[model samples]
Structures are given as structure tokens and as C-alpha cells.
Target: MRTSKHLIEQLASDLGYEYISDLHRPQLLPEIQILISSYDSQSYSLKEWKDAVQYITGSSCKLCECEEIKQYLLSLKNS
Candidate 1:
């Protein structure tokens, strides 16, 4: 599956991450891309999705707090 840079950027923005120029955190883009591609390939579980979100945001807060992320996870779960 091809990872969309636009989706990664949107996810990062929705998750409240600020980017310097077009560079997201040192390794954030790749991580989010991997997470998205893995999901597209039906290789991720809800738990893994939550863990990745937590790792990316550096927060242990409820995943439901982020609607876009929550919706993405739900889609992954349903698939």
C-alpha cells in the first residue's frame, strides 16, 4: 500500500503536533506512514493502534479524545 504524505500530515496535525517547515518530528512521518500502511494491509489491531497513537503523541490520554484517530482505529478494527 502506498502511504499518503497528506494523510500523515493531517494525522500529525490532528494529533496536535507542530512541524518545522515540512518536516514532522524527527521520525514521526515514517512512523505514522508505517502505521497507516500497516492498517491498510490489515495487519494492525486496535491495541496496536492505540499504542502507536500514544507513542506518537507522547500521551497516555484516552484515544477517543481524538476523533480522527478514533475513527481511523475503528476502521482498522472493522476491517
Candidate 2:
């Protein structure tokens, strides 16, 4: 079970951002390439995906595409 923090760190790393663990905030670029790339990866379970979306949406990072990711994840769930 991957925690939200772990997911955020992975996303940051995937996007070429240096994840700062001390801040516990994901340093993400304003690109959605990683999200699109991992859309069909299935590397995480549904619960992990939910947790990640929740964490990203609830965070103070306004630049994040959390809503879009949430919708994508929902589509995946439905399919």
C-alpha cells in the first residue's frame, strides 16, 4: 500500500522535480505528461490512487492538476 506522500514523491520524481520531503509538498512541473503516461500503468491500486488524488487536491498546491487526475482516475474506475 503506497502512502500519499510516496505517490507524490514518485510523481515529482517522474516529472523531474526534486521532491523535498521536509516540506511534504510535491514540487511538480505544470505539465501533465506523467499523468497521461501513467494512465494505463496500473502500478497502483485503486485505494492508492484515491489517496494520491485526495492528497493532491487537499494540498495548497494550486498549480496541480488534481481535479483532472481525479476525473481520469474515476474514468479508470468505471472502465
Candidate 3:
């Protein structure tokens, strides 16, 4: 479950100015791609995966996506 280009664009838009320089590290995008891939696959245990998901998804948090992702993760764990 890799992140799509549209999701990256959405995250960039949500993050606004900081995304231009501060958040846009050379490896950030690629790292995020891997992060979400791991997240969707539940590649880590709940504790580890939650931390990773929080770190990655919470970084660009101008929108409600973070909360949504958290909810989804909780559901996955419960299910």
C-alpha cells in the first residue's frame, strides 16, 4: 500500500510553506512511501506501527488525515 502521487500532493498542500524547505528533505518522500507501505501491511506490532504511523502521518497535520489514519490503525488492531 504505497502512497500515491495524489496523496503526496495532498500532504504537501496540507503542510503548506514548511513543506517547501523544512519538511521536504531529500529522503522524506521516499521514506514516507516506505512508511505507509509498512503501515498498511501492519508490518510492525501495534506499538511499533502506531509510533511509526504517528511520526509519519502527524508530520503534515494541517488536515484531519492524521486522526483518520489513527482511527484506521486502531480498527485494524482491533479487528
**What lDDT tens digits, residue by residue, belong to model 3 across residues 1-79?**
3444334343445445335233344345454444344344322234443443445445322223444554453333211
| Model 3 steric clash pairs | none
The TM-score obtained by model 3 is 0.28
lDDT of 3 at 7: 40
How close is each model in CA RMSD to the real structure? 10.8, 9.0, 12.1
lDDT of 2 by residue, 16-72 (tens): 567534222433322433453554434455554555555554433222344455455
Model 3, position 63, has a per-residue lDDT of: 25
Model 1 lDDT tens row, 1-79: 3444444354556545676233325454554554465344323344444565555444454654334564543343211
Q: List residue ranges in candidate 3 displaced over 4 A.
A: 1-27, 35-43, 59-79
| Residue 37 error, candidate 3, Å | 3.4
Model 3 RMSD, rounded to 1 decimal: 12.1
Q: How well does candidate 1 score on lDDT at residue 66? A: 35
What shift in Å separates residue 10 of candidate 2 from its native position after superposition? 1.7
For each candidate in the order shown, give its overall lDDT on alpha carbons: 0.46, 0.46, 0.41
Error of 1 at 32 (Å): 2.7
